[model samples]
Target: MTTETEAISDDALADVAYLSRSRNRITILEALRSGPHPSGRLEERTQASRSTLERILTELEERGWAERSPDGYVTTPVGERVIGEFRPVVTAMGSIRTLGEAVAWLPDEELSIGLHHFDDATVRRTTPNSPMAEATYLLELMREASVFRTLTYIAPPLSLLQSMRDSVVEGRMTATNVLTDDLVGYLRERPEQTPYWREYVEAGARIYCYRGHIPCNVFVVDETVLIANNDPDSGHPCEFIETTDETVRSWGRELIETYRRNSERLTPETFTEESRMSAEHTS
Candidate 1:
């Protein structure tokens, strides 16, 4: 059975190819993105002549890519869904490829594997019983090691949060988080856990306050190992590797470095906003 993530990926690919086809197609789609539009308006917006635009619209309609109404044209349900799926894929592809190319430009021979998931065991040991099982085992190992050092990353799942918290409580680990504003807000509502919250804050864990979408969740431990999902937009499986691996480690390090550099570019004002918000609730 195709997992939800895989199905979404396929749909997203279809959407990307359709949208990336021609300027006119994109223009028309954008014009009608919000709602139905008259053919005349679409042509004007897309800068296509009436006759030419009509032909294109007719073709799209025939293919069920869009629908016509008295107002103008509207993306069909399928078309809308495709557009929704494709937009993120396009954005993520551009971001990831650009970062990858930049890494390649460096003298390092790093190989970034954009796979759905990584088996932790592959890095810890050579043997494996099942790929899935091995991956789980590897994650546990990483968690155990994470206790002694400071681990940092963007928004991770609740399970990860609990595991990190456990390590910190046991004096095995401390962590910093650069969470989106939304996530910060999410953790703020619960005041009962104020003590735990204080521990994170006092330990120097800070939220990343910004109002934008992050394509994927990244995990880098001690700048030595990096793990990230293949498609940033989709919550597919994730891959992990040691930073020491000539090829794999280099790519992972490059991505972390890129994120760090770009993250620094974030205005201090935004970071402060996040810190303030987190402090208010947790303190």
Candidate 2:
């Protein structure tokens, strides 16, 4: 890739710009990738006027992107490679658009978002009637999984925690949480959750407290990964992007465990001391 990047010539940029100026030209070139097609077939596919089609084909042949074969117009090796690489950029645009505001909160510096990983993902957002839509969807995934882990800077929905606890109590699931110092403080202040936390621990759930690097909330349930963000206005779980893509899931697991390995394991008995250390670290 380094060699290829260095080898890219000024003429290649000009070729790209030239093809980009006319959508019809790109359409015709992409169509020829499969096999040879007559000029009339290209016209029907591109829906361009005869004059426009003829001019575009002439330009393509001149630029070495397409050629007139005995069968018809066919894509050359140069055209094939150009479109093969260019197609991903086009796909990335659609993925970016589909992600919408979720893109803003993603930890892009650490997690390189790639094409196709989230293309077929299930994206959930807080709706007017269901503001906890994102969190609820996570609970749904938890209900079906045998193991789940999370790395978060803020507390998860209490209901989701309760569901995790109950499932773990039945000896049907394993749960682990890698929390930031901020979240430890969040939980420390929630007195109502103290006893529940103890019960959650007794039920075989694991908790570890780490200081930082938890930019966005991550939930990995069995083979699925959910990346979530809060609604800026409501401060509630807003968007949840979930996928079972192996690359993303592998990355997610690595991220969670990497934090956990660096964290201090917490038990019910040590919660207060952990909170105190977290407070001092923050102060």
Give the candidate number with the greatest lDDT.
2
135-251: candidate 2 lDDT, tens digit per residue? 666778788889989888766667877888788888889989998877776787676665566677888889899976667788888988888774446465647787788988888
Cα TM-score per model: 0.35, 0.71
Badly placed stretches (over 4 Å) of model 2 are 1-14, 17-81, 230-234, 272-283
Error of 1 at 278 (Å): 10
Mark the regions of model 1 whose C-alpha exceeds 4 Å error after superposition. 1-139, 146-155, 169-171, 174-176, 189-198, 222-226, 230-254, 257-283
- Model 1: residue 71 alpha-carbon error in angstroms: 82
Per-residue lDDT over 175-232 for candidate 1, one digit per residue giving the tens place of the 0 to 100 score: 5444445555555544443335555444444434334444434454543454443333
- Residue 95: error of model 1 in Å? 20
Cα RMSD (Å) per model?
Answer: 18.1, 5.7
